[model samples]
Target: MKKNVFYVLMLFFVFTACNREDMQNNPGNIEVVQKDPLTAKEINEKINETIKTKGRFSWKESSDHFIWSTIFQGNKIASIGFGSSFDRNLDSNNKAIEAEILKVIEQYEGKTERILLSSDQYLNQIDVAIEKQETVIALRKMKNIRYLEPADYRYFENEQKLGKSSSGSSGCGFESTALSASDYTTVTPNAKAPWSFTKHNIINAWSYSSGAGVTIGVIDSGVSPEQTLLGSSFNNGLSSGRTISKNGVYVDSIWPWSTGYDGPNDQCGHGTSMASAAAAPRNNQGQPVGVAYNSNLVTYRAASNVVLDGYHEQNGVKIAFTELGNNNNVKIISMSMGHIFSVGKIEDGVKYAYSKGKLIFCAGGTSTSFTNFVGVIFPAWMSETQAITGVKENTSNQKCDVCHSGAEIDFTYQMERASGNSIPVLSYYNGQTDYVGGSSVATASTAGIAALVWSKNPTWTRDQVLNKMRQSATYYPTPNSDYGYGNINVLQAVQ
Candidate 1:
């Protein structure tokens, strides 16, 4: 009987120990242990659980704006916004526009900070926590204030927008072949150029000339500053002859800050990829190299996040374009974003930049239905911009998928992505994860080719450079929309 009692005691102790461990690590109430946001599977399970319990299960966390991307540190700003006006001609009287905007925002303004441009137009960095759309609607009620959109941009997190992919057959890949690196203050590791060099004949184009006196502008997420190959040439990338605009306006060669962080920061990782496609440098191994190795990379943070909401807030974008266009040093500007939003300031920005003798490359977008259903997404739709489409051809001789191609597209460029956990492009990124494959990637690649040709023919006008690219592009079919002008041939364009 004593032995039996002791055995019972031992069982009790073991039970207590197990229960204690469970309490410390994973409690019986599993819901209490969940810290991270729910994935699709988890979300479905949660909904079903709530339904099964007939509203017994209460939601754990709640938020108005979904934290789709990397949650930044520090106090989350209550609001963000950009500058706009009911009067389209407000740009003509930029100062008046600022004064007028200031008056309107006064009602809802929490912290007001605006950067007044030489055009007298000011982009409101001032933030308000209230409903900006509703406020804008109310503001429009006041005469002379037709437009008052929020300047702060938000994109659905990469995971939200483009669901994480492991199956190479599915998902998007941003071909950042030569996405330009950040303004190099310093670099050490030799660049190991990737196979993409010879893949697109960029190697042969190198034989002719690499972008030397050129500056390329990348408008996207943001960029990373400490690139080994890109750091080789920093302040030296500027075109001394045309550093400042003819209007006497000076835009810095490198505008690296994105969102709130000062200096180079790419949260989404797309910006660095896009920049590398524009102008990564040749390294010892050249594992990751840009098309315009010799050119400088100037990153423009137009959006705080990936949500471009049809560019209702065009102020920041306008400033970026204004800087790139006015600065003669920036000969090419590559934009890899597209949306269903109608023609607006984006079209104007492209027009303005092109007028300033800068070649512009824009992404065509991957929505297959978009190509057949509505039409090409703008600002790629804009005539002034060279809308680049994507083709998935492994080799020059391979027949590729139409993918993002459309008749409106100016040139077709080969894009790459890997199945599972591989990033195929020669690229650089700040975030832990990366992605490739899109019209944007193709656009950057094409921009690199243009940079190559332009580097060889430094004196060539933007028009001449564009024509050479179109004429030299490989052919898919004359009347086919599958491949526009055809894949860009760097060798042929240079030859």
Candidate 2:
């Protein structure tokens, strides 16, 4: 009887050890530990700490638990991307991969309903709830899984919830300031030409080409419906035979599956200024004129503000880029908005646009609430984009007080006046003008110059036009450490 009991005990121990080994290998049945949400201050501190130690911060390297704790506090949903961003042929295969991923989630969570919140139509990305860390670990090990990050993380919203006032400082404002007479000079037809036009000799370039044949796509807040200069009056005065189209892709909801798109209108004043500075008509009604006054314009309301901190903002930008990329008429694409770090979807969108032969320009960076430590922001820091920043008049090395400069900066625009003023643009309202400064206006102005170059050489490829612009810039053979190729001489470029 004792010998039989000993044999039975050994068999029980052997079975228990086998079960433990299976659990270690699979991890699908393991329970995930829940942690409390992090405060806004804590989130900022963690990001800063990562930047200090890692030289750069990426959501790809962060753990799934940390991302959930910091970003998806109330909801446990996570955004994920699979397949190569550069592979255009992976769309068909992505569906099968997505199915396999869903199966893995079902195995871990023991559920099959409502596991997928949303999936992108163009790119290989999806949004789903991740209740277990083991699911994240399994997803990471899967083939072609690019990234997993928070889809609806809004830093400024969290700050506001904490009773912090962030007005006029987050680069988001609806107030339009009155412009001074000194800010512009009266051109033909009683139009107000921005003072920076003389600094860059854009007036001379107009004699060669007014960006007549090229179309510029401005991805920003939607063009203001109140500003008639960008609407019905777009073809008045010297600017005629061109068109302006406005699009809105921004979704004003936290839900990724929401289909309601905010209409094509400038709820924020920033987009109106950017549009005016790039392609506002040179009308006879004493309104401010754009650099490429005759260039066709297509503006998109891609985000609520200049800062891209939420899922909808980033998603809208991606959609805008893809749409602009497919538009054969669009030769140049400009965006004055960006995030402090790289967002995977945005990166993929930019690459797609670039692949379609669109000359893309992005803002180097403007001063923000917590981005003082950051350099050139993404997607400006990307190689596929030409990074532009604001420089003071009469000097290429001196940047504007609110603009950022770094090695990634590819060009500079003389937008900052000596008298503490900025570039003059048509106001969001009719019959008025406002002054816009920083890298935002600079990038748009650069895009206008590119339009002029492309218009002059209509048959030239995108690289040929870019090369001509580069050869005509201040520093051509060797670029500056902080300001790449310096400022482009618009007159020389058009010639």
Candidate 3:
């Protein structure tokens, strides 16, 4: 018992003192982590796998496909491409590439539905029926297309690693994603602060324009339209439970009963929070205000299954972006999702969207706390997408161990010193108020600020909009891997 207690205390100290964003002072490719000492080196040596790189997702389909990632046993496949080098020219060429990908998928054989894993149904894990239907929807109900991603295996590895949580955690929980508030001061309408928030400076920029006439696309789980504070343009100007359907299949849903879907629809409540952060219009009394109050929201429900493998998740996201880019309803797109393995077509989609004058902002998923966490994730690491890290109020410019800032622990760490004292991203949760903390939340916050800047500089080219934002960053002239040209200064960017 005493030894176990000691072990727990030691772990606490290691994690508490360790910076969550720690990494080699390199600028990219965080996927190649130094192999953990606990990992069995010899166990990896015996495989003589042969794989034909025929299927796009062959890596997950069979061990034979696994051969593509490894030569004999030692060097494994690391990170994939980000849209970082993705250019306007590439964006212009995206449509053709998308057409090719769809054409390729069409050559496959069935309307088959494959179900690999499901989150405990008690949580909001999105309906498998809905997820399966989406692939059908994406393929345009091609009765003959055999683009099935239901049971592929490779995508399940990482998720399987996280199947269990150390302590009390929710279904979509990651211990690293845990919200802490030890030293935070409570925020309220009458609340005063020792210092102003870096992101909140966009409020001052609002004097110039309040993100009017801009459509911010949230490419995640669909938003809860019932949240009146969120004020979605879809349902009577309120983000609420009004479902939209086609062929009797609900594509966008805020409520499951009417939609014929079960399982917690926004299981993690992640999508709703992101949407709210980007543009929660009717800020309730004593609650936080979103960056873009007047902007409209268009949610592309991409993350249909909470516990899906990468093939399913990435394909869903790609389809979502394709639709969003094609329609051109939104000016800015915010994606707070990331993973190591990336689908090439998705990067193409991002460049294509950017070329079409859409702004893409993504979460830089690496946190310093874990020893191996470094660099950035796909999509976010892509050039067309602005990779955003977190900047806690007091921790700015210090390279603090967080989503972005380095080595300077500030109000963020302080917030977790006590309960109710937090520096979390406050947004809509299903239809209620909820808060979360992570680099993903930071991405959403950045999305809101970008809307503010885009609104003020209406008619600027996509590259021009991004450049103005880059110039307005605190680091301005110089760009650092940690802060990425420093925090987004909405006022300076607009002025």
Local accuracy of candidate 1 as per-residue lDDT tens digits, 1-495: 999999999999998887753331222212322233334344334433543454222221222122211111111212222345322344454445456545544444333554221222233223332332223333333443322222222222222344532223222233343333331112224443333455567666766767777777877756645443333432232211212111111122222122332234544556666766666555444345567777766777664332343222243455577677767678888877655333234445666677678888887665432123223556776778887876554533222232344567777665642321112344343212233556666788788888888887888998989878777766633524645677777888888
TM-scores for all candidates: the values are: 0.58, 0.91, 0.58
In candidate 3 the C-alpha lDDT for residue 223 amounts to 54
Estimate the TM-score for candidate 2.
Answer: 0.91
lDDT of 2 by residue, 366-412 (tens): 97655666789899999999999999998888999889999999999
Q: Against the unseen true structure, what C-alpha lDDT does each candidate score?
A: 0.50, 0.83, 0.46
Candidates ranked, most accurate by TM-score first: 2, 3, 1
Best candidate, lDDT? 2
lDDT of 3 by residue, 1-495 (tens): 999999999999898567333321112312323232222222222211111122112323333223222311212211122212333233343344333333422333222332212221111111122221122223322222222222222333422354521212121431122233322223333211112233445546766866777778777665554444444333322223332211111133322222242222353556766765666543223234456766777776565433223334544565566566766657888887764334444655676677677888887653422212334556676767877765444444443244433221111111111232333343443233445555566677677777777788778767787788777766667666455576666788677
Each candidate structure's count of clashing pairs: 36, 0, 51
Model 2 accuracy (lDDT, Cα): 0.83
Candidate 2 regions with alpha-carbon error over 4 angstroms: 1-40, 53-55, 86-92, 159-165
For each candidate in turn, give its C-alpha RMSD to the true structure in angstroms. Answer: 19.4, 3.9, 18.0
**TM-score, structure 1 vs. true:** 0.58
Candidate 1, overall lDDT? Answer: 0.50
> What is the Cα-based lDDT of residue 325 in candidate 3?
73
Residue pairs in clash, model 2: none
Ten residues in sequence with the least summed lDDT for candidate 3: 408-417
